[model samples]
Target: MKNLVALLLLSLLYLHGTTSLAEDINSDAETLPAFCTSYKCPRYQLIKKYEKFEHRIYNATNWVTTSLKLDFLGIGLAKSFKRLLDYINGKNSEGLVMKMTVPVRIKVPRSDILSTNATMSFFVPPAVDTLPTPLNPDIYVEQLPEISVYVRSFGGYALNSDYEKQAKILVEELEALELSYNSSYGTAAGYNDPLTFFNRHNEVWYMAL
Candidate 1:
């Protein structure tokens, strides 16, 4: 009788452990970054990881972008986001409401003197063949070739200054490695909802020359 009681207790403990582990896995899946769940986002393989940088090879991707030629980065981004959101909300010629993707990318020129114009882009999902024509003339679609890039990632809310600082760090690391990269252009990628307060993912990407 004692042995049977012992066996029963062990079974109960085993079931409890399994249940807890399953719950933990479900919680983790629910908390995955938006970038990982989006099929439209660029696919990349991590080639190298450094203390402050990562080298990656990214596959070719299609994008829908809007150009905002404003002096301030924040203002330009705001306008671009508004325009792009409208496109995704069915403000297009086909009146199609596109799926929202993660890691909204912004490209900036790489001059010491800041440029007035910047391009903000969203990834086009694979199933979207009949591309919607943007009602706004400033928005357009383009297919980009596969490229290799070095990236620096950071947490929390991303501001222009944060991106600039991280980009500088990546450049220094690349120099240390004797790597050549395109200095004329770079991209900033954001991978979190606006309301996310912690563990936010932001990255600055520089193309390999």
Candidate 2:
């Protein structure tokens, strides 16, 4: 009978230890910031939420950007991405190896004119106070002002054509709701690496007129 009682106590202790470990792991995961998980962009509060879209108001922030004058959208994006990566890899005046933050942003032409010039930008991590000077003349840093944007989000891998299509759809939705917007230019915000398997988040943003 004493042996049986000791065995029960041992089993109870083992069970309790297992449960505590599992809870600790879960708590740690929950505490990790969104930026570390799923390549979430920098922290920003949603100023206004709508049925079809939301208004994201971002504070003034700095960006590292590269401009390419390529007629092919896919080719241009690929080239620009490589250039931006170089900057993060210590190709700068300060030789600072900057931490990459998401949504890699692209400024697309407003119309379907197939222009040769487009701009791609990467957000500077919040921990950065001073902008690093780019070694390449074409790659420069800019401080953008506090801005409000209307955003429509979607999933899946996005190409240049996809951005154009999504931009059109977002404009139509906004028009139906009688919301005024600046149709001159649209920006594409991508929040995932190209190799991410599923639930890739992308957004089409327009400055609210």
Candidate 3:
């Protein structure tokens, strides 16, 4: 009876160890970006990781965009968001309702402290081919080529001021590391909506040279 009981204990220990090992392997093999969990978002290849930013190569994709020229980034973003939201909500020629995608993007100017002459864009999902025409004259579809960028992520309820401050920090870090990047403009990407009060994610991207 003693020997049998000892064998059962050893079998249990071995099983537990195997389970732990499998879990660890799965954890390491995770490839999806954390912020992409809630919706369909673009995927990228992680080229390198630094103390301040990550270098990634994103594939070519399509987007629906609208132009904005406002000194107040916050207000402009709100207006643009509503416009794009309408587009996905069947405000197009085809009247086809589309699902919302992740990471609303703003092509912000790096030369100025304020975000002026920006373009707000929503990513077109991979499944979409032959986009519908926008009812709004200002809204149009554009193709973005595959490109590499330096990305810095932060968590908070991001406002205009928040993005500006983070952009400065990201630039400083890149300069400190002697990295080459485009100075003319950067992209601000937000993963959460305004209603999401907690654990919000945002990113600043500089085009890699």
Candidate 4:
């Protein structure tokens, strides 16, 4: 009888262990992070700005160097404009924005982002770079374009995986709009705080074509 009891106890423990493991797996799958299909408004600060617009030019005739340059360019601009947000709106805002000298679009050709990076570098000024500034009480979000776009917002690092997910969601939304996109013409915008995760930082995916 003791042996049977022991076996029953062991069986119960085994079942409990399996059930817990299954629950954990289910919980983890359920907790899988979700992506937002709308825009986000984060607090921002404005430092200074030059009156009137200036046209910046960039040339990426070289492939390797241009790739790095484009990466830096994106990073710098995201920071600089975030600070500039303080000036445009108020001491507190949720984001920053600017009108592209030209309608900007991301075109990954032949699934070749590296080559496309070189070509895309031809759009912006070469010397122009993102300038970091001290945080202030302002947000400088750019004006929303008249062109219809399905914006997907995400937090944390704008990893390629997150981008892929957002891009897919945006495409699906656009399809519902009856608008055509090449699926390669994606434009990105995002915000991040150097200090905290709870702070408002978001990335937006758009179809620029």
Best by TM-score: 3
lDDT of 2 by residue, 35-122 (tens): 3353324555688888768888877778898884445324555667768877876788887775555667777566544544457788
Which has the higher lDDT value, candidate number 3 or candidate number 4? 3
Candidate 3 ranges beyond 4 A from true positions = 1-31, 113-116
lDDT computed for candidate 3: 0.69
lDDT digits (tens) for residues 1-209 of candidate 4:
00000011111121122211111111111111122112122112222221311111221211101121123225423333333332222222322222121112222332434332322111221122332221352321122223434455555644444555655665666567665555544544433322334543343334334
lDDT of 3 by residue, 1-209 (tens): 00000011111122122211111111223346778665667778999998878999998988999975554224555566678877877789987666666677778565554444667788877766678999999899988899899998888766556667777888898899889999888787877655556777888888989
Query: In candidate 1, which residue pairs clash?
Result: none
What TM-score do all the candidates reach, one by one? 0.77, 0.77, 0.79, 0.34
lDDT value, residue 22 of candidate 4: 16
Give candidate 4 regions above 4 Å deviation: 1-110, 118-148
Give the candidate number with the greatest lDDT.
3
TM-score of 1: 0.77
TM-score of 2: 0.77
Ranking by TM-score: 3, 2, 1, 4
Task: List lDDT for all candidates, in order.
Answer: 0.64, 0.63, 0.69, 0.30
* True-structure lDDT of candidate 1: 0.64
What are the per-residue Cα lDDT tens digits for candidate 1 across 1-209? 00000011111122122211111111212232354443246667788888888888877777888875534434445667778777876789987776566567777777522355567788775556667888999899888888888888877676656777777788888889888998777787876654456666778888887
Candidate 3 TM-score versus the reference: 0.79
